[model samples]
Target: MAIQIGFETLVEDLPGPRWQALFARLWPGYRAWFLRSGAVARPSYLESRRALRQHMPELVPTWQRLVELAGGGDVEARFLSLWCPPPYIVGCSQAVWIDPAGKEEPALLRNYDFAPALLEGSWLATRWQGQRVAAMGDCIWGALDGQNEAGVAASLSFGGSTVSGTGFGIPLVLRYVLEIAQSTAEAVALLQRVPVSMPYSITVLDRRADWATVFVGPDRPAEVTRRKAVTNFQHRIEWPEHARATHAAERLERLQKQVDGPGTLEDAIGALLQPPLYQSAYLRGYGTLYGVAYRPASGRMELLWPGVRWPQTLATFAEGRRDIVYTPGAEAPPDPDDAALAQLLTESRS
Candidate 1:
């Protein structure tokens, strides 16, 4: 049998009925994952809120409104804060390319690789914190990747490490950066102060073609580098098994070679759709579901799947849905939420 994955687009300037419906749809599955390790394993609502205030004060008001919309439950608030939640990881690759053709602005490219069932698949355009932001949403409100109206785009790839500590999840951190930062330097500065539960490499690109990859983790300080092409590791491979399984070294080498030389944005997008970077290990929880190209300078972004392209802009975003059909039964990995996610998708279709 074929499994179909659904994606939806939602536009709201602030929290309201539309956002409430989204929470109603996604919270059940996310709640299962959040409590997988038991409620005690996660932080208390007070602790979670406190951490958010200390590290990202600007998000507090929006977080409060979203929590209220979710019925103001304790678990809902804690999970939405994304503070030191259960550990999870993804296999992804990202890069910054200043297309030589000049047909478009400098672009940020990303391939989000993970289990199909687990992807929240919500495309959102919102001005929650004053600045307009367009992003692929995860965990209800957190951003998996996104760009702001200021022409700043940011994407993240998991840093190859098995470490987890006292910090927020990367998704919300990405959301925070896109919410407030206006430049690559500003984004890097934002990453430096916030702790991340796991190591992640975030590539931030601005309209001026300025970009940098910041490596952040709860255990250490954030490190910024000029590397344009980033895969799932920093400095060295900390998780050999994951690195080998995800072909981390191979993917990084391939991306590095491509970005090091001059190329058009068209060629760069084509390169990501090819081998090593465009993964297909869906069964293993590391398949490339979609490739996205962000032209921050032009305020445009394109979502790619083989030949199909769905383009959107902050100024003109249409709410819709796209269902991707996939063959089921990949040797289900140990990802805790895969089973819950599968059920969620199944129910949504019915």
Candidate 2:
């Protein structure tokens, strides 16, 4: 059962007051967790608020509202699910399959049917903090697991037995990386310093085209693994058998082979769309939640939502004013479908 709900709206076009009010409603729990962790570099939320005010004055009231919400005790563990930072002022470019023709054909890209239970009031309102942060939310949204504005993208999966760390979860860390860093190198540098809570593998891509995968642990940075292919678990590294067995090494290997042969981001995306590939069946339990593509130059981000049951592709543009496209079922395999996408994959490959 997959629960995914997404909507699209232009950031600049939204009513400023209404948007601020929405954030005001959602901020308490997120701010509480960040403050409780003591990981925030600046101790005072006021200072952070002041800084954001300097550039985005509109968000000041929203920040204050979050403070008020946090004071009410309405925000507790519930808010801890996903606390993403504000959208950084940066460019983004992305692409995804959409029913441009409105053909409802079975496509890999489509809107998700969230479980009704998950749609209870505050949960949906809080989770889909839509136009609130704009660029920053592009990274924070679980759709593609990456931040588009900062030209940084990341994806994470549970490693089960092999991963071990005691710090912030990858999703939060990915948000932090998008907020504070400007480039992939900077993001990697920052990750090296943060105290991670769990053992997980992170693949980060920056605007400058630099990419690296860092393996994290409880004690220290275990290994900075490098590979074009990434999966849910750790990659080729000498760790304990207990760690190695659950790493999903073979999946990465097969993915690498596919990429080496096809050698394009589309190929990588296609490989990711395939079913699980762990012989022991452990890796089978944990598969990809979705796939995302971000284009920094255009400030656009596209999300492909194909979970265990609901398989569809959806696209959202940062600059364009348009409703999200939801395609049902699976379409033809993505083999350089459009010229624009082909060009993007080529450039990304270079």
Task: Please provide, for model 1 over 123-207, each residue's C-alpha lDDT reduced to its tens digit, 9 standing for 90 to 100.
Answer: 9999998888999998888888999998899999888886879999899999999999989899999999999998999999998
TM-score of each: 0.92, 0.51
Q: How does model 2 fare in lDDT?
A: 0.38
lDDT of 2 by residue, 132-231 (tens): 1232232122222445455555544333223333344454555455555667687677668765555555566654556676766555564676655544
> How many clashing pairs does model 2 include?
28
> Cα deviation of 1 in candidate 1 (Å)?
5.7
